[model samples]
Target chain A: MSRLSRFLKDNGISVVFGVGFLLSLIGQAFAGRAEFNEELQSDGARPVGFFEYVATSHFAVDITENWQSEYLQFFLFLFGTVWLLQRGSPESKEMHKAGLESDKDQRVGPHAREDSPRWAAVGGLRQTLYSRSLGIVMLTAFLGSWLAQSISGAAALSEERLRGLQEPVPWASYLLSADFWSRTLQNWQSELLAVGSMAIFAVYLRQRGSPESKPVGASHDATGIEG
Target chain B: MRTIARLAVLTLVVGVPLTGCAVPQDRLEAVRKATERFATLHTAGDFRAACALLTSAAREEAVHNGGPTCAQALADAELPEPGAIRSTDVYGRQARVELATDTYFLTSFPGGWRISAAGCTPREGRPYRCLLKGD
Candidate 1:
């Protein structure tokens, strides 16, 4: 294959999602700017330009709130699946294989295959870190995004309060406010529900060739068997 | 590890507005000074000077209210003394300065911070009612 084609093939999933995210973000900017300008006009304030609106706390908070929740969902899933078992769900490991398996079972240490990751072949802190790296990274992203949401949300809330002739709150106060919790919980509940539903649905559903689903001919009780 | 680091860097980049885009202290101080000057000009009976400090929108509204000029309208408004500055809060291009006796809302323009509303009194669950306000 040509270099361009080889690169595309190797990174197709990321490229697709990256492009989709950019398009969606652009769409959000246009829609958000229009809605923001409408409210500004109604309040007798000057309308902001598209770039200005995008840079505002109003936009930042909205994006960060959703991003944080998504990272939280993946973080929970990655950590939860390590010990939790769902008998019929391909999303989970086999029921008998629950909990952290032996080092040999994980192809670590003496049992490491020649193709195994270097850290997996090592024994000590590096191996330990590599084992939980997925969960660690997801958790880190979750915390970072949550922090971003809080900061941006506080700024947005302060602007609204100032517009209403109320005193603008400090970051600590805003973090404890109903507005902050409302934004967080609203996104969180949706993400949690979607993840839970997907886990349960995968037990009975078959998506043919998708790894997320069991094979069409597979039994409903078959655990940890991906198509 | 590299992927995680890249993800973190990307998030921080996106978080620029949240992490370090706070309204600068210098900008807040400039607004505070402008507010004090406005109150000082009004208290000194320099209505024209005070009127000159009003935002264009506010000045136009003041002029159209009753008097033919912003100065005449402001002089007729009978605003209370602002006294010493108590506190000032600046968010983005907007600011609110609380004086010992009154509150004022200011908006930043290319020229500088100008009074959008003066002689303001807060109302519960509503925007402040002001003797001089932009339309």
Candidate 2:
């Protein structure tokens, strides 16, 4: 019991992310396969096996479009925090604080009393970049998902032509079509609405002890920090 | 007196039509009827019967393409019941009729009209593209 508890305590975040990813992927496979078969049966077409279906871009676009939007939300949030502030909201920094805080305030460089990360002290551009490293990683992930969407969307388009007993359109043309944009924008809208609403709502709402919200006792006008 | 009056009315109706020449059946009406019959068979999941109604050229093409025997092909299909005509759109010799599970694009054949293609289901994993035929 103790060993399991210790392992979970030390690796809870990793475990959560890993399991969530696995379940999400499994869900995509099942739903996508069912929808695919339904369409095939309607057209007097053959149904593809699971692994083969996964290899096609139809699945790729289905997954990547959502992934890109999620990463974009986090990336935007990370960078937006730098200059944007909402008074009394735990999501933002103080109203007037802008750019990176001081090294001493951040507990690194010459201000380190010895427990500081080795890289934090070995400063210059490395330290400068690390200051906003969260944003960088999120932005990189967002770009990756976007690229995956385009590649998969093209493959899906070609498959459609083949089924129609017509010549397949090239990947380049598919990328520019209304179908692709419509799918992308539809997903993007939902993500944007969620993020935008949460940012504004956190200003007035309070959840005791939760880092996502200010403490109930905190003043309604408080700009940053957990109340 | 009643018998005479009834006979006079019957003669009036029969004589009016025969007086000149009989009216012709509109070509559009004949075409529409054929299309309706085609859609009815398809929606009932009777692909063989439906294929039998096709023009000879289409039947040849289906066989040449290595498609399943018509009955076998229909076994996996999902369709509305027979006698339901969702919609019918005609353009001269070509027409498109949307049934519950299939949208058939047909051409005027010697027998009447035969389906050139059915556009209903999208390609597997590619829901945006309609799959009309076997890959």
Candidate 3:
């Protein structure tokens, strides 16, 4: 295989998901544009084209709201596993290994192996930062997306209000509105439920070939064991 | 982490709404001009000219197919005396122009802005009560 082919083969799952994301986003833009135009027509406004709809806050809010929740789910999962444990699930560390493990166990600082990342072998802030980079990045993405949602959300709402000949609410005031919390919590609840259910389900369930599950024949009480 | 998160949110909160809205100045001026013309024509008792400035839906509301013609209906409805145009706010393809005595709601068409509602007065928290409206 060529170098590019080797790289694609090495990251097959990410490549597939990346392609899927693009396809779904394009699909969303088309569907969203149609729906948006229908709404505009009802309001006695002119129908916007596809490109115009894509630039609208209605589209931005829809995209960012989902992105924020997904990022929050991953951020919580990554950060939670350090201190929280589910004894019989591969999704968690062993009960005895709960909380940030010893530096030696984590192979950080003086205990890092020769091939370990340079930051992992260093001490001080760099080591601390590299250690929690995944969770930090995920959390940051969640906050940024949520903020974007709020900005676009305020604009979209204002557009609706304008259609009705009502004055637009200020962005600061919109943050306190029921609509803001409603959108945020609606997505958060579903994600939290899914992760919570998965954690508990993996305690007893088994999948033979998947790394996300323990060996089918492994003891049901086994923890932190992959197929 | 907290600082970064707060900064990201703060940047967007203060920045996006202010900078994101880029309504074309020409479109806004067009809306304002259309609103003033509707008011001007109505004030001059040029109901035929005024009827031309109304949206198709608003014209229908005025005539209702079974009613008198649009110009005749406007001559009889006794809509408020439209005062001088004050301000025009255009959001997307819709606009609301505040006049000295009334509010006019308009929608942008290929031809230009056309009044969908005219001689509208505030009704507390409810939608404006207009002498003429589309829906």
Ranking of predictions according to DockQ? 1, 3, 2
Name the candidate, 1 or 3, with the larger lDDT value. Answer: 1
Q: For residues B1-135, what per-residue lDDT tens digits would candidate 1 score against the true structure?
A: 589758656865455445424777789889988998988899899999999999778898998895798899999999898888888887765789988877999877767888988888888767788888887
Error of 1 at A61 (Å): 0.2
Q: Give the alpha carbon lDDT tens digit for every residue of A1-227 in model 3.
A: 89999999998997899789889989999999999889877876678888877777788788888888999999999999988988889998887998888999999988999999999999999999999998987897888778878877877887787678676656798899887889999999999999999988888887779999889988888999988
TM-score, every prediction = 0.90, 0.62, 0.82
How would you class the docking of model 3?
Answer: acceptable
The C-alpha stretches of model 2 lying farther than 4 A from their native spots are B1-135
Cα-lDDT of candidate 3: 0.83
Best candidate, lDDT-wise?
1
Model 3: residue B105 alpha-carbon error in angstroms? 2.0
Q: Give lDDT per model, in order.
A: 0.84, 0.63, 0.83
Rank order (by TM-score, best first) = 1, 3, 2
Docking class of 2: incorrect
Alpha-carbon deviation at A112 in model 3, angstroms = 3.5
